[model samples]
Target: MTIRESKRLWMACGVGLLWFLLLLWPMLGIKPDGLEFATTFKVFGYVAVAAVFIMFFYQVKEAGYLDSVGKPVKGAAGALAAAYEKAPTWLLLGIVMAGAIVYPLVTERYAHDVAISVLIYVCLGLGLNVVVGLAGLLDLGYIAFYGVGAYTYAILSINYGLSFWLCLPIAAFIAAIAGCIIGYPTLRMRGDYLAIVTLGFGEIVRLVLNNWMSLTNGPNGILSIPRPELFGYEFRSLSSMYYVILGLAVVTILAVYRLNYSRVGRAWEAIREDETAAELMGVNTFLLKLLAYAMGATFAGFAGAFFAARMKFVGPESFTFLESAMVLAMVILGGMGSIPGVILGVLALVALPEVFREFELYRMLVFGGAMTLMMLIRPAGIWPAKRVGRRSEEAE
Candidate 1:
């Protein structure tokens, strides 16, 4: 057989072997009914999935022909005009519809936890991208706004009798306000100093939540947060929440894309490329910086609100620095400036782990190692920013 066929056959066999081993876990010396057994099986599953992903990554890297894209992408567009020209909206619409229909089937029968988490992360990552990726702002405590959103919805709706739908806008508004508070002082700060400030800011929020018993109920957090419903039906199942999250994610993606190509987006880009030059050219750099921060925070808030509504839980611990790091990693690791790349990065890093179920701890370690290695190899990310095609090529 040819090498390609041989590879496929080997992969198929490997998968079969994995399933056999998964089934045999209980039959081994481990006790089936004990907590230890469950934990051990979970770890086994994680190691298996991690091994598979690493193997896949290595195989693809060795191939060296295809770029390490987060996911499939349309051809590169050099400018806003190019993106508009190449996008072909109708086809994109068709694909979105197909996805919406498929999302329910996949999440309901197969699994829901990981997919939901990824969808939430997708929204959060896209939100953070506005600041970190497009606007060149470092927001280490982006999760603070997420907490704000979640707590806003949870507190208002649960305590004072508000609706989940009403809380969405309110949560966003609160997050925007918080963003302005952070952005005003830090506009002049950039790079390491700014990074440290944001990190500190995130910690401050978490501490406040822990200490401010009246404001955040200390460690208890807001529980029994109401879920969104369509018409008379509450989003009772995980599948129900999946659709809601998916809709929000789509909206977030579209909004980010629009901003990326709009006048403000250009202004942000100008600032990112050279802050002094942008100011020299009358970009209103300060206001734009604040706007970027507010908008980015607002989106995170929306995601956090949705998360609160679905899970019916909101705790300070939920919006920790590690969460911030993971979200930032998703944005940077995905490809800072590329939407498709970001999506792919989220899927691989966020979605894959939830589905696999076997390798949570070790998988994280492996991914951390892989990311460090990737920084050395391709710092721009898996899908590097594409330069404009030469006009000389048109003559040919």
Candidate 2:
């Protein structure tokens, strides 16, 4: 073998060993009350064997075997896309909608819960897609608006005895107002600075929710939020709730898909591509951006209210910065500007972890590895937005 290849092999081995050592102590060594040296050594032996297999896999992957396997997958994906483009749009939509409507019937309660969670993230991802994917706005404080909606519902339900139907629009409106408040100040900012500002805003909101005991009940959280009801029939069953979220998810998908083809969506895309050029061309860049923020926040608000109603609780802990990051990751991984891609990303990220719950501790590690591999193999995302061939004068 060449020296370069030899070095790479050793490097892979070193990485596997390091991972084994670092993960071993936490995975098997630490006990609730004390160290478990015997268990640690036993697990270490298993990990060592696994490491060898991992090293071999990495070496073979480096040798391009994975690429050869991936070639057919890529070709299949291209063929699928071609087929989708040629299919009747209404037929495709009908098929998808029908499947979504029946998903709760096919899955068990646990899987239904996971599906509900996935749909929630799908909604969140689609919302953030408007701000980040369409308008190119980096919003790390998006979860703050989500919190706004959740808390709005939680507070209203707990104090005023308002129904879910009543609180839904109110929560959304509050969140949209919060979005406008944040968007106005950051209208001229972009890139890393904008990200930092949003991050700080998110932390600030979390802190407020944590410390404001008088209004929010602080870290204890607000609980006993009512679920949605129709004609006085409460949605008490898991399947019913699943169907509720499923319906909402469908509405969100349709709305976002429509927006993507609308004039407003085109304006956002123009802003994403070149803010200065769009402004020079007479696009109301400020107003359009605010609208994007409001619209995205509006969806997040809806999801948040649904989450509150579904879980019947709202806490500062639920609206962490990591939640925002995960939503953003879903948007980016799915293909930043592609709706179907975002849905797939949410399904993969949310459902796959649950599917492998036997290896709970290793799930994050595996997920991170999978994401890294995806980035290396498909940097543009699994379903990147198609670039428009030519912009019409009206579109510009």
Candidate 3:
């Protein structure tokens, strides 16, 4: 509110605008014919105006100018939170389940497809949450397990004429084995080194799938993977497939929720908070770490099998590092270690792209900007997990 602070704020904003313009010009203004400034300047002008407006609003709010307007809104939010806290757990779950059950019936085919994708990511996100969120392990190659499950189901269904239901567990088991293989050597590593090793393992899986023609068909991908069946009925319709994935997601949710409060979950948390201390407490860090990876990969394997069934195809391209990163982002964005947070994250990231599909070229630009803004504003996540115990830093 002071003149000096106002000047500093404006100066920072101006510098940021100029830097943004510099970056935007190269991307939007450059052409084979010649450099152009009109389009770039137009976009820059809109952004600058929005930025200025936001900055001014922030200053006004900070100066308490908006207190009158904000009070009622804040009070309403507080009341809502209080009511939510008082609500029964089963009632809340029933509402959510009802909505999910009705989603496919109300939406069109495209929406069904998107919903299916969202559910798939939900499973993937929760699985990753076990390792990265609960166990405090960084896994950049998580999609490799996804690929393993998909290809496992794909090959089994195609080669031996196995049923989708039968191959699901087989795929999950194989993915678990793969997880243990990846987790073993990295037991001693931590932080960035562990991240690098996991990244390598993910790429190694992709490369094997890409080059191993005899097994994976070398990028041609396995095709005609049968849809899941119950009795003699096949899930040939999108709506039916949606239900199938919904079931898997529900199962994943239950399994993860149980694990989160289990003794194993507590041990993983202990290991995450301090591995050395956990070992001193006789926590068997080695086997538990392997179990974390196995459990995480098992869910991903289920998802992969479902994915293969849904798409009727499996390819190396689908299991790329970028996919892994996006799933990880979903976990971080929603709130690490929180089941609901992971689901919300999956919905946001998956739905936003489709929602912005009309924007065509600038969709990613907008998406990236939104993500950056979110990280800056809510770095802890949209819905961070609640910790059971206070940390040293929080002690007063």
Candidate 4:
């Protein structure tokens, strides 16, 4: 073998061995309460086998054997893409809408619940997409806006006796105001500095919610938040709530999709590509950035209100840096600036974990590994935005 191949083989072996040794503690050494290992060596054996497979795969990859095997897979993917591109837009939309509408009726309760979770993230993802994807603004505290919406609904419902529908707009407007407040101060910043400022803002929001006992009830959280009512009928059942959220998600998707193609969206895209250039071309950079932040916050606020009503509770714990990270991950994984890609990301990141609940503890491991692999293999994302002629404008 060549020196390069030899080095790659050694690297692969080292990585596989390192992975197995590092995971040994959590996988085998520490057992959860009331859990049985059944066989002392079962987990270890699996890890060992997995390590061997990884080493073998790496060796094959280094030797360039995977190129031959992957040709068919690539060909199939190309064929699927071509077919999808050739299909009529209305047909695809109809198929998707029909499936979504009938999903709750056909699926089991657990699946429906998971679907609701996916939809919530979809809404959040689309909202963030406007700022991060379109405007090139990094927001690490997007969840703070979400929290704002939930708290708005909770405070209004309990104190003022406002209905869910009435509180929805209020929550959105309040969250937008919060977004503008954050944006106004930080619009001059970019990249890492912007991220740090947003992160601090998110922490500040959470701290206020946690410490303000008179308003948020501190860590105990506000309970018994009322469910949404439709035409005087309270949506108490899981199925009923699922439908309500489905309708909301649909509206959100439509609104975002429309906005993505509007004049505002073009301006946002221009700013994302080059703020200086966009500003030179007569674009109001400051105002558009604030508008982007507010618009994204608006959808997140909508989702937050739905989340509060659905759970019948609002807690400071629910809005955190980790939650913000997950939403950002969804936007990145799916493909920034791509609406359908964001939805796909939400489904995978949200539903896959619930599907594999038995291995819940290893979720972070999987997510980290998946993200690493994605960055290395497909940095542009699963369904990256393409700049094709007039067709691109129409398709998007």
Candidate 5:
């Protein structure tokens, strides 16, 4: 690296470290009885030392001092990619399915719970992927559909004593209707305006759930929701529930995969790239956008129905804006428009918090920091989707 660039790098690192120290001290050093610096400095020292080491190694790598080690690593990565491309699709899918089938048998109940959560989010992520990733619709209130589905199942199961299997499609249908309702008014909006309308819609749903005493029980939440039953057996165990969600997730994956390569998927992509051009080319931007919302919300409804069945409850708090953001984050972080990427993102975000549960108060702190680092290091995502063609500058 050039001397000027080296100096600038170190300067930026120094400033960042100072800023981190300032933020860290106020949080850790301020106590109830008195202010203290010992604990704060101790933690800061560890962070500062680690940062310095990382920067030093980075600088060395940039200077080509690690070329001998880097070259082999890069070659190995390329070979692995080539091998992956050559592998049969069924073989890869079989391996994944086998692992999933065995997961509950190998892990404890808590692990099963986390896995269930991951699978549920996977469904949500893929559903949202349809609108945000493919159609370029920025939906901030997608969780409202989720809530709709959950409440649909909850109400049906409790009031009418409907079976979980029967309520599933019913929930999906209701959520799809909700999606169209929300998507209709936002048809003319785009970017920030669309986001604001969706956000409002989501909050409105939450408020209704919170205040609708007759239907939602005013946040007391519905209870005694029956578990899903197949034939004569009820899914009352965690392992059984895991399998249920696993099947649902697989269905979601298949449906989304088909849509991704279909004519509708191409239309969504065209609309995403340039809505005006898509319209000029005879694409029905209006109906397709509404379809995107409905399709996306359908999977969410499936997930929500399952969620209500598993939890035996549905409440306004569960469908908060934060939940919507997290689902969106999973999509963006994993690689929008990629099914596998969404699943990986779901696993990372859902499992990481469980893994760091021992950290107690610092759990979210570590999670936020990791997300920021991931964004900075790979802004496109962990595994970005492959587009049809490259831009002119990129091709050049």
Candidate 6:
């Protein structure tokens, strides 16, 4: 059969088998969490409908109802396999986008706290992707910028009684400065040495926060960090923070996307491929690396400032090495250098704990096991850059 005809049948089988896969989740004598069921069902229902619609579109298109004047090689099976490999990841994206939108509409619809936390991480992941994934800089001290932003906002808002709105830019600027400070000395290192230095930098920042009682109030942290008030219509409702965070997340994604495609992005890619070669090509490798570090930290700082303002409390414990490593892990686990991949990694890492609460005690163990399996199964990443092309008989 021709490649086109082969794919038509392959997709058909995939759709047909989806139902059976759902059944594998187990329905026999299943116990439900009655209260959360409605919310859960709403989430699943929207996802299911989206999946059906997509499949319907694909079905109609394949039947020649939709004209495709174009189309790949490796015979029927190899090309079919390549197509199938990509389908699941894209399908999962549609489901995730749908869930993120309708999630707030579920009962108890305004889980602002949960929503804000998620967005903060989203911002964090995007930022880290630049450093670890794009620039090939392994940063384990990201939380330093976070702490700086938090304290910058905290001190300014409390002592000077400055508005959170006004403090936002200042917080970001200070975080950028902190990023430069950390990046300067560490520019000469790479790999594990870089990781260790960054890790130490993070500890130093936290210790300063913990012992600088004269300035930070030490362990007590700051309290009642002001929340964003829009047009004097302050957010008394939970959804307000949700919308604010959503707005920030949208901005973060956009900025990161632009950076990913810009001239600077090309420089980072060159550096990632080979630092020495990139520098030799007049890329200003050292400066670019520092820029990545600063820019990445600035993103975290923005999120941290917002986090402090939203939560109304902050402390050293919250911004630690573990948090830094976790964010890096998300970026790495999600295909490094892939924006969407980093996002997926964050969602899975963050959500799995909530989804499988029954296995709470073994969460870390399960997490390690899953990572090990992922390494074995998809060594490149959950979403690698592209399929490496191979020679064909026709080309030969």
RMSD of each: 8.7, 4.2, 1.2, 4.0, 1.2, 10.8
Runs in model 1 deviating more than 4 A are 1-89, 106-110, 385-396
Candidate 1 has its poorest 10 consecutive residues by lDDT at: 69-78
Candidate 6 lDDT over residue span 1-396, tens digit each: 357876786677567446534542343223474323443454446546766787677667666665543232236667888887778866976786677667666736435455667788889999988898889998898978888988999989888988877888888889999989989999889889998999999899999999999999899998977777767877655676776777778788889989988999878988887999888889998899999998898888888888888778889999988899889888878888888788788877886676687856547756886898698888767876542244486468
Instruction: Return whichever of 1 and 4 wins on lDDT.
Output: 4
Give per-residue CA lDDT, model 3, range 1-396, as digits (tens).
Answer: 898999999999999899889888998999999989999999999999999999999999989989999999999999999999999999999999999999887889999999999999999999999999999999999999999999999999999999999999999999999999999998679889999999999999999999999989999999888998898999999999999999999999999999999999999999998999999999999899999999999999999999999999888999999999999999999988999999989988998789878767777777788889889999878899899899888996
Best by lDDT: 3
Rank candidates, TM-score, best first: 5, 3, 4, 2, 1, 6
Worst 10 residues of 6 by lDDT: 20-29
lDDT of 5 by residue, 260-320 (tens): 9999999999999999999999999999999999999999999999999999888889999
**Candidate 3 backbone collisions, by pair:** none
lDDT tens per residue, model 2, 57-176: 877776787997889999999999999899999999899889877887887889788888998998899999989998999999899988999999999988998888899889989999
Candidate 4 weakest ten by summed lDDT: 34-43
* Model 1's TM-score against the true structure: 0.76
Q: Estimate each model's TM-score.
A: 0.76, 0.85, 0.97, 0.89, 0.98, 0.73
Query: In model 4, which runs have C-alpha deviations exceeding 4 angstroms?
Result: 1-3, 30-48, 54-76, 388-396
Better of 1 and 5 by lDDT: 5
Better of 1 and 2 by TM-score: 2
- Candidate 6 to native Cα RMSD, angstroms: 10.8
Candidate 4 residue lDDT tens string, 215-323: 9999999999999987889988788888888888898889988988899988998899899999999999999999999999999999999999999999999999999
